[model samples]
Target: MNLKTYQAQTMAQALAAVRRELGKDAVILHTRTFRKGGFLGLGSKNVVEITATSGVNVLHPTEKRELLNPSSVRRNSHTQMERKISPMPPRSALEPSGPAGRDHSESISSTNRSVSSKDYLQQELKLVKQMVQELLQQNRKQQHPSVPEELFSAYMGLINQEVTRELANEVIEKVRSQLGPSQIMDDIKVRELVAETLTKMLPAAEPITLETTGKSKIIALVGPTGVGKTTTIAKLAANFKLRENKAVGLITIDTYRIAAVDQLRTYANIINVPLRVVLSPEELRQAIDSMPNMDLILIDTAGRSQNDDLKLHELKSFLHAAAPDEIHLVLSTTANQSVLLSTIKRFSSLNIDHIIFTKLDEAVGVGMLFGVMKKLNRAVSYITTGQNVPEDIEPGSVGRLARMIVHPQKGSEISDDNIPSIAAGEIL
Candidate 1:
């Protein structure tokens, strides 16, 4: 066997070296990464080391033919064995009439069938592997023609997270343009650049703010049904009242579901905050007017299906009457890009001031949020991770969101303390 070790600054380069030296038939034995060539480890550069080998006894043309056609090899062996024993039998004697002849014919038939089946499976498996490799190569070329090999993994990571192909391409192209060729070889530098590009793509996180001396900061949560708007409202109310020490009042127009009103009412009672349920726009105005002393007034509207024009119009009328300082369109991260975009488009007439993404823990990836924000051009206020009242909610941060999109595996597991605070104009 011919064994060799190859080293390069990046895995792509190392693999390229292995393929060039050992051919495609080489089997990888081991791989590792280490830092090398720096004084006292102060400026050491990371290097990828790989060990690979071509197996012993490279097959000759004849041997290769026998390996591919095992039936031919077996036939030749059987002919030689017959010649070494008694002379070859006559055709009539070989017929499956007698008991011994029948057993012999059956054994020969089974061996041939076994060999044929094994050959068919081997061919099929080989074709499938080739198809997969071709598809992967084509995908890389189609998705990222200009993307450097060193940065291809990051580009694919975004796509795997459900980021739009156009947006993912734009991000990779930006990273490639900003860094010099040598600098792009650094994995850490490429990651930071990818995060930075994604951060710039996101709208700034603008959570609701309260005025010191003015009418209460009326904020409304509106979205499609079952998106946890009521629970999110409770979370916001609890954070403001208990954490920020602000006088918060809750108003619900979700009379369609008695359970939703009762849920919010129960939360209000526990938090010692006033709760009001209003049916009509007139009563909604009366509810707001009735809470003049409150610092923040959170109005939870009934979830209106984006497809229902009548319900949307009714919800719009109530929002108009309240004249909220901010109308946050709550969206769930679990929805696909089309559903989210459609919801935003349908609700655009309501003048969505900002967005609040809920159900982060339940989502596979938050990459769709990037496409939604890019198209809507609205700022994000907050994100809800779970059903926890106050603990699951966090002020949306561009850094945290960018990180989530870049590293989806860790996105769902992020906690309050460890959440990065990279808002607009900030990076980590």
Candidate 2:
């Protein structure tokens, strides 16, 4: 048997070399790809290697003839039928203890080796095909021709910040479409255009506000476990009672956690506002009715896991009973986009009026927030930056959120006062 190995820049090239040297009858034993010729892996090029063998007929004469020509097999079908009928020999002749038996055993072993080699080749080809597909997908993502070179950095920035590629492309494409051939070359102009485009995509920020008819504004906060719902409730309560000097009432249905109830009670006492701890949906309604004179009533419910259907059902019952003027779903920015989206989808049945993003200061990037808001088309009412009551929380601003998505490094530096004003009519 003759065995040889060949290497080339591609599988096609490598196989061409194998066919030239080993002929068409050669059997492939193995194949692999590796990087070659690079300093510190900087300029490496992919090389394909193949191992093949020839000069060994692994197939029987009839099988080889059938494989080489299908039409011949149909023409010789009668001969094949005769051979199959006369295949059996006497037991002693088949099991002869001599050099003949040894040659028969050797032939079977060679056939087995050929079968094993064929299986190995098939498996390697499957893996190689999968790798090629993955490389093609990565290349398409990296070299998306629709995004120009000038906006490529901005596109990558959005991706690194955890924005979905689809959304990033949408924003970049919008920027490209708006900018002229000359403006695309200007880096600062491109950045500004990207920011402006992001700002336009955002829904208008609608913060909690009271009506002029002296009617009480009932607002409730709901979310999943450990998302700082209680703390956010305190911030909203304090801001209304202490800062705005409006009559504020605090109600907590968070009886599941004694600590959460106590925490809200502490804030109620500090802010010198009325506090109600309700157990059942009936009591929740009664609590809201009892605080009719208050200008703003902030209700904080116990955190329920999105996956817990029973708990979510109970939460919905409570919200239905309260029937608050606004239902703000409080979400933490620390959670990833998928989790955030899933939570929203689960809680969507509650008729979520707006979104309240908490833990903004702890988030690695606010881009996911932008993505969620854009995808859901939900408006943000408030954003909590830290743990400080009334101080860390602020009304949601589209300009501020857009700037953070565009310039993550300068997110911490952006403030309500410094956020560039976006025209209301420009909102998408």
Candidate 3:
């Protein structure tokens, strides 16, 4: 047997070193984490040290066959019993008390210790394999259970679409309750029933439009960084001003990034709308007052980090000042369910009632949107499918969203002709 020790800043690096030197058959003996490379531990980083061993003996197929034979097994068992019952040799008679004798005894002891360690490792390895197999079987049973043959495909489709297990179970339960057992076996009927149930469960708000509300509608867009808040705002501004001929105003509190301001300003300039850049809550109030004559004031806020409480609080202060008529929390449909939920929970402080899913065209699986809508129950206002301004944005209709969840490849069927130039009364 060969033993080696490796040290690295991370366990992954240490494991890489072990594999590089000992090949793939090495067994990890132990690991320890300690501080390294700092003065008096003030700035030290944690380091991982790994101890491993290799050179385990693996029996060949011919040797295993010979050992498994009945006659061979009997002979081997008898030999083992004889050796166990045999008397120990007298130390004095076996070797003289000298350096050579001491060296011989030490060598035999080392060999016995190595043999014992090898046997222990083999036993542990066998037990681990058994445990792993049992766990895999259990996991498979949990993930896929016995269901009617007709509905099995629909159930698998839901799981494959990235819907969470709990929500998928809910969908299945609803199908079971709504459809009779005879119809449950009809795959097409089962899928239709599931889609219909999901559609009702998903909440959708019509697009924000100026015709429904006589007063100036103050709409604020809030969300984390890089979720395309600026672009989505630009799309809304363009669609409202150019298509609907409504008096549009723009105010952005996103001074955190120069490019964001420049980007929004560029859109404002193209649409011939006034763009106000406010730094504090007081400035936001002044900006809102300045836009009183405008029919709709679209306010863009700084992209905040969901986990940064201070930033979110600062955002809350801005929202308090503006007191917008509607707050839309922009999100990406491509984000995983956990991240989407966390974003929603953190931003819930602002009393956000609307959601905007951006980058819909980039998502391979938008079924996560179903989980999000089910959890938050907040109506989604629009979904931005592409980068093209005004054209890519569409109202998040219930039927379209449901179809996207059930059949992702089919995508939203809401044609460009059907989407209103502006949100009807939904924004108000």
* Cα lDDT, all candidates: 0.75, 0.74, 0.72
Where model 1 places Cα greater than 4 Å from the true spot, the runs are: 1-135, 415-428
Ranking by lDDT: 1, 2, 3
Q: Could you give candidate 2's per-residue lDDT for residues 1-428 as a string of tens digits?
A: 56688887766677678777866556554455677898998998877665666554444556644534534544554436222212122121112122222122233223323343344446657999999989976786677867776788888887888877888899999998998889988877887787788777878787886877999989899999899898888887777777777898989898987888888889889989999999999999999899879888888888889999999999989988998999999999999889999999999889888898999999866878888887668888888899998688876776777777677778778765643221122222
lDDT of 1 by residue, 315-339 (tens): 9899999999999999998888899
Q: What is the lDDT of candidate 2?
A: 0.74
lDDT of 3 by residue, 1-428 (tens): 57688887766677678777876665554455667787976998777665566654554454444433424433454334222111111121111122222123233322332343345446667999999989976775676664444566677678788877777777877788788878987767877787777777666565785645567999999998889888998888888888878889999999988998999998899888999999999999999898777889999988898999999999999999998889999998778888999999999898997889899888756777878877778888888988887678877765566556666556655343455545565421
* Cα deviation of 66, candidate 3, in Å: 22
Better model by lDDT: candidate 1 vs candidate 3: 1
- Which candidate gets the maximum lDDT versus the true structure? 1
For candidate 1, what is the TM-score?
0.69
Clashes of 3: 3
> Which pairs of residues collide in model 3?
207-423, 208-423, 209-423
Top candidate by TM-score: 1
Q: What is the TM-score of each candidate against the true structure?
A: 0.69, 0.65, 0.64
